[model samples]
Target: MKLSSLRFFKEIVFAACLAVLAVGESPAKVLTPDFVDLAEKLKPTVVNISTTKTLTPQFRMRRQPSPFPDPFQDFFEHFFEEMPRRPQRERSLGSGFIISKQGFIITNNHVIAGADEIKVRLSDGREFKAEVKGSDEKLDLALIKIDAKENLPVAELGDSAQIKVGEWVMAIGNPFGLAQTVTAGIVSATGRVIGSGPYDDFIQTDASINPGNSGGPLFNAEGKVIGINTAIVAGGQGIGFAIPVNMAKDVLPQLEEKGKVTRGWLGVTMQPMSPELAKSFGLEGEKGALITDVVKDGPAANAGLRSGDIILEFDGKKINEMSELPRLVAAEPIGKAVKIKVLREGKPREFTVSVGRLAESGDENNQKTAGDAFGLSARELTKDLAARLGLKESRGVVVTGVKQGSIAELGGFQSGDIILEIGDKAVATVMDYEKLIKEYGKGDVVRFLLRRGDSNYYLALRIE
Candidate 1:
């Protein structure tokens, strides 16, 4: 109970308390000063977009009588009679950023897709009626213009190509109709393909992007717009996708001048170069798209490109995967001759191809018939069959039927599949396939190149 002892106990208690507090608190991340300032400056440029769409309902008519007695039957029929549903008006909310002081804004195509009226509200409580100037559904991008007399704050679009993973980013949007909601996170990855579209090079981030965040601006550290918030993985947390600003910049001129997107076509069907395929071809690395079938008389065909060639580069840009090829070719100007490098028989070759406008129906096809040696029945592909199969050229023989429990069926051969090649030799007719089959004796395994729908793969079938 002495004064000296009491003071020592109090000091000990204070030291224990400090130790507990230190363990509970972790080191905080030091944010750059620009983050807060950039977000505040960019807020005015981001706007909330509301769209209204009127949809009409379609009703089906019933002519069959009701199963009931006379008077009751008439009442039942009346009750069951198909009544036309009234038209309904749907309202949706999204977000966008002004690209120009003249009231030009950029957003997602789906935001104003079928809207009859679009209203844009700014942070300053000002509202304006907007009209869609252009949109590209493939890229899911839209450009709209509003007649605003007031000078609007514009957000600068930055180079997304220069952005690196783990860099800080911010997303500003009207998530769930909550206007001007801001979320911050780091770039988790780049060039992500979620299979949402053909050109699906998305910037994946951990930003808290939810419903209604689509069409918003994803800002870089400099407060510049680097991406357009587009999608999020369903039922996933901390996963969101944005369209890179570079892609938007490349297609902006086409959208502004043509009101739609036009892409250059090489007229070739391709698949990713798998490790097995790469090893078979004696390649050191797998980094290109394997050409499955080439469209006859198409740009690639005219340029001397053939099936089984692996496209290494397009227009001097290295193609790392099969998906990258489509985006690269699409971005090229139509009719422009571009240099393409391909690996054929393990040797690299370069060619200059005059790019052609991509046709909506561009797909490759081939045909031939086996002589019952493999228990498979097939016939040469005709123009009609090719068209029905959505094929560009009639080159392969279509499998008519595969005998059950037979070698062909056991080898995964199916009806409606076109056989393009037999052991590196192209099969263009029934005789070609029959001659190839005759060359194979009993118990001999041969690799067959087959086309099913738009995809191509090689299968090995052993002759019985």
Candidate 2:
């Protein structure tokens, strides 16, 4: 080999060895958080809550005829009807965290709902009686107070909006009657809806939460309270949900002052936009909420929002999902004017609407039958029928019955479903439904807007 070539080969070997040394010196560090200090620092802020409820049993008069005749039967029935029933006591356990030095604490509304008595136990083993100051059933949040006579340790509140997926979180609670248990895990997801209620934004974590852990605190790495442990999936391991601290913070003042929550109402029944519905409306993608029904003289109607308009934005926030709009609207101040952007006839339009207070009521009625083509029978909705069916408006045809193994059944149609619109046109009566059904022939696809229970959605049916 030539001398110069030998020299060049040595230089290359030296460079490769240097590269290997550099790589060996800089390996990534896997950090495992030591939660002992964090847990100890925050445990004093957490409390174990126990609730007691009294259930009174009622005796009812029996209508059945007794074997004894006349006077004897009447005497026996009177004796049984006048018998005194015992009042049973029900006890439940939960957890909470102190929020203020003035003895204010935050817990789940369900934890102390209908509770006749409540007790709180601190980490120092001191116990005190608690009284519910205020509660909001919609948000499932409760504010309670205790006369501790001394300053209490309070947990620092953190911004849940800053929380990222895969971040370390610690949950401290009394799970299954065990007090002051600490569990650690990472955030699995955010903004999860488990069909719990209308505003169901939950933080998903793998932190072991159980029955007794309800109303506990979920702490971030800095030992700040980020979420309130609220729910768990039945029979599912490592899946627990917490209410974001931000949402709780938003209503805490109202709960403390009013003892209830007052939400703003948009007065529109909406359904999620699907790709098929978007295409039918000449849109390329499904990114907005489709209005099924607008309450007459309500906020949306007053703002000129009509059925078939797709809501693109509420206030200043873009609505990416149908569920987001309700939460956004509910959080707005009542009587406040807000801008709503919508797509109408493939064109973008905006409206300013004054929000109204939500007034919830229930009832719905219906009769006439059109069956055979769709394998379902439907009738015109009447005001009396609407009230009976728990509907607020009488503006649709109600499904009377569905055929077995038919298109209606296969398409998730059930008896008692209110058909609000057929093929983007409102079906106010059985005559309207019949007229719309005739417009679509065999092989044509049609979309039906329906209200089942408190939810609204679209179902597509293809003519045979």
TM-scores, all candidates, are 0.67, 0.70
Off by over 4 Å in 1: 1-30, 60-81, 359-464
In the range 264-356, model 2's lDDT, one tens digit per residue, is 888887777888999999876888999877777888999999999999988889988887998899889999999999999999999999999
State which candidate has the highest TM-score. 2
Per-residue lDDT of candidate 1, residues 141-219 (tens digit): 9999899987789999999999899888999999999989999999999988664556878899998999899999999
Residue 391 accuracy (lDDT) in model 1: 55
Which residue window of length 10 is worst by lDDT in model 2? Answer: 360-369
lDDT, model 1, position 301: 97
Prediction 2 global C-alpha lDDT = 0.84
Error of 2 at 461 (Å): 31
